[model samples]
Target: MTIQILSLRKKDLDKIIEIENESFVNSWTINDYINEMTHNPFAYYLKLIDKDSQEIMGFVGFYIMFEHAEISKIAIAKKYRGYKLSKLLLTDVIKRISLANCENITLEVRVSNIVAINLYQKLGFEIINTRKKYYPDGEDAYLMNKNLREED
Candidate 1:
C-alpha cells in the first residue's frame, strides 16, 4: 500500500482520534488536538494516509521552538502495525525541521515502550534523562534527544 504524507486538516480529527485511542491508553482529547492546531505556533502535525484505502494510517505531531523540535505524539493504526510507518514519520519530521533550521529534536517516551525507544535510538536520538511518573497513570518516561549538528 502506498502511503501519502500530508499536513493534517480539521476534517481528519476523528480518524486521528481513532488511531490515537487505538495506539495509546493515555490518549489526548480531541480538544487538545484542536487547540494544538490553532494555538500552538511551534506545532506541525502530519497525517499518513493510504492512497488506495484512503484511510489515515498514522500521524506524527511535533513542535519547533527557537532552535529545537519536540515530538509531541505519534501513533499508527493497530491493524497497520509491522510497517516502517513510524520511521517514515520521524524521518519526515527530522527532514522538515532541518529545512526550517532547527537545532535539536527531543521526545519523551514511556520507559516501558521498548519498540518506540528502539526506533528513536535507530533514528539517532539518545537517552538524556528520565522523568518519574510522567504519565497520568504513573508510568515513567525517558527523555531522548537528537541534535541536528550531529547530522552534518
Candidate 2:
C-alpha cells in the first residue's frame, strides 16, 4: 500500500482522534486539537495516510521552540501496529525537526511501555531522567532525549 506523510489538517482530526482514543488512556479532546492547530504557533503535527484508500493510519504531534522540540503525541491505529509504521512516522518527524535546526528532541514515555521504549532507543533516544507519577494514572515516565546536533 502506498503511504504518504503530510501535515495534519482539519479534515484529518476525526481519524486522528479515533486513533488517539484507541492508543492512549488519556486522549486529547477534539477541542484540544483545535486549539493546537489554531492557536499554538509552535505546535506541529503530521498524519500518515494510506494514499490509495485515503485513510489515516497514524499521526505525530510536537512543539518546537528555539533549538528544542518536545513530542506531544504519536499513535497508529490499532489495526496498523507491528508494521514498523511508528518507526517510519517518528523517523520522518525527527528528520523534519532536524531540518528545522532543532538541536534536540524530548518525549516522555510510560516506564512500563517496553515496546515504545525499545523503539525510542532504536531511534537514538536516551533515557535522561524520570518523572514520578507523570501520567494521570500515577504511572512513572521516562524522559527521553535525542540530540540531533550530535547526530550531525
Candidate 3:
C-alpha cells in the first residue's frame, strides 16, 4: 500500500478518534483534538494516509516550544499495527521538528508498553525518567527523550 504523510485536517477527526480509541485506554476527547489542531500555535498534527484508498493508516501529534518538542499522541489503525507505521509516523515527526530547529523531543509511554518502548529505544530515545500515575487509569509512564544535538 502506498502511504503519504499529510497535515491533519478538520474532516479527519472522526477516523482519528476511532484509531485513538483502539490504541489507548485513556483516549482523548474530540474537543481536545479540535483544540490542538485548530487553535494551538505550537502544535502540529500529521496523518499517514493510504494514497489509493484515502484511508488514515496512522497519525502523530506534537508541540514545539522554542527549542524543545513533546510528542502528544501517536497511533496506527488496529489492522495496521504490525507494519511499523508508528515508526514511520514518528520518523516523519522527527524530521519535521528537526527542520523547525527543535533541539529536543520527548514522549511518555505506558511503563508496561514494551513494544512502544522498544521502538523508541531503537530510534535512539533514552528513558530519562518516570511519571507517577501519569495515565488516567493510574498507570505509571516512562518519559523518553531524544536530543537532536546528540545525533549531530
Candidate 4:
C-alpha cells in the first residue's frame, strides 16, 4: 500500500478520532483535538494517508517551542498496525521539526507499550525519566527523548 504523509487537516479529524478511540484506553475528545489544531500556535500535526484510497491511516501531533519539540500523540488505525505506520509518521515529523531548528524532541509512552518503546529506541530516542501514574488508568509513562543535534 502506498502511503503519503501530509499536514493534518480539519477534514481528517473524524478518521483521526476513530483511530484514537480504538487505539487508546483514554481517547482525546474532539474538542481537544480541535483546540490543538485551531488554537494552539505551537502545535504541529500531520496525518498519513493511503495514496490509493485517500484513507487516513495514522496521525502524529506535537508542539514545537523554540529548540524543543514534544510529541503529544501518535496513533495508527487498529487495522493498520504491524505495518510500521507510526515509525514512518514519526520519522517524517522528526525530520520536519528538526529542519525547523528543533534540537530536542521528546515523547511519553506507556510503560506497557513495548512495541512503541522499541520503535522509539530504534529511532535514536533514549529513556530519560518516568512519569508515575501519567495515564488516566494510573499507568506509568516513560519519557523518551532524541537530540536532533547529535551525530547521525
Candidate 5:
C-alpha cells in the first residue's frame, strides 16, 4: 500500500470532502473547500493519495499567517482507519511549514480525543489553553502548540 503525500490541487476537492464528511459530523462542503483553495494565500492543503487506486485516503489543512501555522482540519477515510495515516499527513504538514520558515504550529482538538492528543504530544506539541464548548456539539477543545523555532 503506497501512499503519496502531495500538495493538494483543485481536482482533489471532491475526494477531500468525501473523507472530511466521513470523518466529521460537521464537514466542510465542496464550495467551502473551493473558496479556501482559491482565495486563501496562507492556506496549505495536502493529501494522502493511494498510488494504485489513485484515491485520496486522507488530507490535512492549515493556514500560515505571519509566524504562526494553525491546523484547520485533518481526517482519514473510514476504511483507512487504524493505519496511522493521519499522523503521516500531519507530520508532513508540520515539516512543510517548518521548511517554509514558520515558527509556530497550533491546533484545537476535542478534549475527549485522547488518541489525537497523544499523537500530537508525541510529535512535540504542548497544550497552551482550552476553549469551553468550542465544537458545535458543545465539546471542549484543547488548544495545542508545537514551536518550530525552539527545540528546547
Candidate 6:
C-alpha cells in the first residue's frame, strides 16, 4: 500500500480526530484543530493517506516560527501502529522543515512514552530538558530538540 503525505484539510479532520482520540489520553477537539488550521499562521498539519484505499493512516501537527519548529502532536491509526509509520511521517516533517530553512526542531513527549522517545532519539532529537507536570493529568514531559543545521 502506497502512502502519500499531504497537507491536512478540513475534510480530513474526522479521521484525524478518530486517530487522535484513540492515540492519546487527552486529544485535541475539533475546535482546536480548526483554530490551528484556520487561525494559526505558524501552524502546519499533515496527514498520511493510503493512496489506493484513501484511508487516513496518521497525522502530525507542528508550528514554525522564525528558524524554530515545534511539533505539537502526532498520531497513527490504531491498526497502523508498529509499522514505523510515525518515523516515516516525522522524517518527512523534518525534511519539509529543513527545506523551509528551519534551524532547529523541538517536541515535548510524555516521559512514559518510551516508544516515541526512542523514535525521536533515532531521528536525532536529544533530550534537552524536562517539564514538570506538563500534562492535564500532571504527567511530566521530556523536551527533545534536534538541530537541523547540524545534520547538514
The most accurate candidate by lDDT is: 6
Give the residue spans of candidate 2 off by over 4 A. none
Residue lDDT tens for model 3, 69-98: 999888889899899888888988888888
Residue 13's lDDT in candidate 1: 95
Per-residue lDDT over 8-125 for candidate 4, one digit per residue giving the tens place of the 0 to 100 score? 8887888888999998888898889899888899998888999999999889899999989999889888888998888888889888888889889999999999998998999999
C-alpha lDDT of residue 55 in model 1: 91
Candidates by lDDT, descending order = 6, 2, 1, 3, 4, 5
TM-scores for every predicted model: 0.96, 0.97, 0.96, 0.95, 0.92, 0.98
How does each model score on lDDT?
0.92, 0.94, 0.91, 0.90, 0.88, 0.94
Q: Encode model 6's per-residue lDDT on 94-148: one tens digit a residue.
A: 9999999999999999999999999999999999999999999999999999999
Across 21-135, the per-residue lDDT of candidate 5 in tens digits comes to 7788778998898899899999978888989998988888899998889999888889988788888888888888898788999999999989889889989999999999999
Q: List ranges where model 5 is wrong by over 4 Å.
A: none
| TM-score comparison, 1 vs 4, better candidate | 1
Clashes by residue pair, model 4: none
Q: What is the C-alpha RMSD of each candidate to the true structure, in Å?
A: 1.0, 0.8, 1.0, 1.1, 1.5, 0.7
Worst lDDT window (10 residues) for model 3? 29-38
Residue 50, model 3: Cα distance from true site in angstroms: 0.7
Candidate 5 positional error at 73, Å? 0.9
Worst 10 contiguous positions by lDDT, candidate 6: 11-20
Clashing pairs in 6: none
For candidate 5, list the clashing residue pairs, or say none: none
